[model samples]
Target: MARNEFRKSQGVVPFGVGATVDFENESLMSAGLDVWPSEKAEGAAWLKIMEATQIADGRLARRLSSDLKRKIEFFLSPTEAPELTGFQPQQQPGRVFMPFVRFPNWYFCPRCRILKRIAWNTQSSPNAAELKCSNMGRRVEGKGDPCGSLKISRRPTMSPVRFVVACENGHISDFPWSRWAHQNSDKDCDGGENGSLYLYSTPSAGLAGVVVGCVKCNSNRSMAGAFQKDVLHRIFPSGCPGERPWLGPKGVEECRDKIPQTIQRGASNAYFAKVVSSILIPPYSAQIQQILDRPDIWAEIESLPTVDGSVEPFLRIKAKNLGVDPTLSFKQYESVAPTARWMQKAMSCRRKYVIAMMSTRHMEVLGRQSLSVTISIRREFPSRTIRIGSDNSSRG
Candidate 1:
């Protein structure tokens, strides 16, 4: 295991979460470069680290003074041309908090069941952050403490974990975020078609970093989004979404004029009788005959010609809610039309279902799995439904 990693009593590291920082040496005066063997060199010259007087203090000091320090400071100051983040004392340790995460179900993976038992915050170290393991994943070699899905590399010293995501068409990619976010380097390999994978770049052993790949459409996105929300809570941006709606509740404007109005005429009117048989609503969305005796705002609606074709409902959703009385202005009321013909249809069908397909790589439910759920009785299947599912990724 890496000397710098934190481990728990169970001997595991919190794997597959966003706790890692994009740490680079970013040093103005490299201490180890001068000590490295001669074979390693950059360009046509050996790596040269400007020499400085090295000092040691038994206690960590908030400030220091030295000839070497002054020269380095001249170039490394915050305002300097090559300014760098000041050196931090490596001896000081970070607080080792207990950690746990929740993941999705992986019933489809039999041989990889124990992969879930892979290492976690099992031990603490100052030099390394990982433990060497024998866990060769199904697709990748190195195993995560909880069974890894890391992409593999052949080089041992450069032991980077590649996160390869495969699309349905078999276009597999190492989801390297630095390459993706910065759009620099490795132009030779495009993410390929149907780029649905998300990339998380993190520090590894040496030279290179590890990349954790995930699909945007994985059942675990919500779970992962939740886990990430807390992990990067301080750094997360606004408008962030939870497991479901990132936009939160539907607003009144969103429901514009979708709620139905009372009958324009009295409930006993002939026109009311003609349309009475055509109305279908769940008990929650409907009421008794007397309730309709008085006009709702929608009941006052004077012949605004119904838009032709499929756009009739667009008026309710885009502009206003269903009328409360026939006289109500088209712009007056707003709502998610629970009583619309389509909404009614959506609420009633037994065989009907809704799914949120993934953004990348084609995936489907296991053919053998069956799910049945009862919801408010509706008239027709909703034209839209969101997929609500999850997978085997750690959550906390």
Candidate 2:
């Protein structure tokens, strides 16, 4: 779940595509609703669909594709639709679907901090629902519960551990508790059936007091430097495990990037959504625009005679047929195409300038080192008159 302060400051909750959200003791991604079923529901029904007008931005709308542009335009524009009883026709005018990803139904007991998988739906067996620690019967000095007996807790007492392992390439997965605790210079626990791991937290609130240990090999490691940069690589020289839990159980990839431990799901560096957007420009001229709108007419125009055959006749004929002015000359129609082309080029240049300006402004605002680049354009013009004398000003 995103922090309340972050959501408030952002003025919008980060619940769109590639967003990480916590629900039912699990971290999940918001999948695109376009992949959802039209009739039957496959995943959880926790999403609340709303109108797209709430978060609509003109800048974002300008970047939409033709299909999405048409849909959003239709929704925002006034149009008539059939009215139904007990429902306002304009209540939910738009269809902007939210994306979601499947999350593992796992939980950790607060007292023991041992990981456990639970069912997706616990309402059916409410009376039998409980998380029991694996080390319930194990006895050690100052270890286990206060009585050192089997520990049982209600479902509410368990919460999902907020820790997750992430790489610089944006791959995220559950923390490697078994590998971190067992695989070390002093101990080489294979994490097989014989290896069992447990987490312990001291009275100190800092991460220095947190510990992970393997019960079988008696190997333990502290969480003190886990949050430090490149510390995981130093501890486990094998590099990241390339785990992508969001993609499911078998979605592992080959990644050699440094993996860092993140303590909270809502951390600023936890998830980064990669998006690419474009601005769509419409045709400018009504005469050429009409021809471009229909592929058949455009193809016919391309197939016309080219050897000294004037395009004015074709333009005039097409313009007359399309109810446009027959007086529209080829020169007038041809000039409109370049206007649109120049507009597109200008838009591209403006976008680049805005991005560079924003980057410079951000560095200045944060009092960081300002990166500057200098570019010079040299042009040579033909001299109208050349001096024969080469005393000082003449050069080859």
Candidate 3:
């Protein structure tokens, strides 16, 4: 029976998609409370498992089933949908193609209120023919266009699509989002604000490669893919995480340090990954193992350390290699985009002191030391401001 339940549970998931993430995990991980809230913090501590996984590795959300997606979106509907009751207008898009690899923001519209997925693509051709909605479309009254709009009501969307593997044939097997939408899309949905509807949305190349087919075929294809993944993990040079050997932050960096840290070989990524992992994730393994634990993830982190947190304006500005000419002064930016684009890190401050979120760009030179390239991150995201409390320099 459990086997049947497992199969049923797996039926609705979408394959080749980024894992769903839970904010709750971030909170728990941040505090070093690794045990699942309900379980007693027992034998094998969660910290050990985390360190084993490399504290730097991102904790991806467990793969979700398509049915789970629907349940999640349904719960998110209320604030997203503005028009609660109606003869029911605004038909949903069937097989909607989101242009962006991963959309940053997505939600049901509050004004018109329907499950709407935003497709941000500069490549959308205005001259290209409009793709008609698969279901009934809205028709024109005295409208100039001959093809009238059909009021098909709703189109099945990914928010509720079951997470299931695609068979080689390209059909969605097990549970189907299409059939489910036909029955439930019309129900009263009162989830939440559209902005909050989908926070875990990540961009990927898989959806762009999607090929439609029958469900039975998709199931077969998915199983084959899963089998292949297992094979690769087993036969590859590195075995699944084990005691035989180690290649984590300390070990990987130790090996890399021997090669000598340099941007030339890209060995520095391992080091940076370690930094990102430490700051972003909880000190899972480090604390548990009590081995080489650096509590202040950014102990080495420097943000133009200020003598006073509340310094009014001019405190002691030590400018180094800052090519700012005496004639040039602060020119208010016309558009924030340019600022954000020119530099990757932005400037944020604690008080009057301006802190630059700049990283050193190690440029290798033949005989001399690696040149440091200072980039302006503020130029990358111009919309952001000092209030963001971040420096704008970023070294690519």
Name the best candidate (by lDDT). Answer: 2
All candidates' TM-scores? Answer: 0.17, 0.46, 0.17
Candidate 2 Cα outliers beyond 4 Å, as residue runs: 1-13, 32-106, 117-157, 188-195, 234-238, 260-263, 273-396
Candidate 2 structure lDDT: 0.42
Off by over 4 Å in 3: 1-153, 160-227, 230-396
Arrange candidates by TM-score, highest first: which order? 2, 3, 1
Evaluated at residue 19, the lDDT of candidate 2 is 46
**Ranked candidates, highest lDDT first:** 2, 1, 3
Which scores better on lDDT, 2 or 3? 2
Tens digits of per-residue lDDT for model 1 on 1-396?
211222221111111111111112100010011221212222212111111111112111112223113211111000001111242322112111212211110101122221121122223222232322223433232343322333332211112221212111212122223223323233344332223223233344431342323232231111122112123222222212211111112201222111111111111110100000111222322222223223442342213354233234433443334433322322222222322333334434422322121111111111111111111111221333321111212111
Worst 10 residues of 2 by lDDT: 353-362
lDDT of each: 0.21, 0.42, 0.19
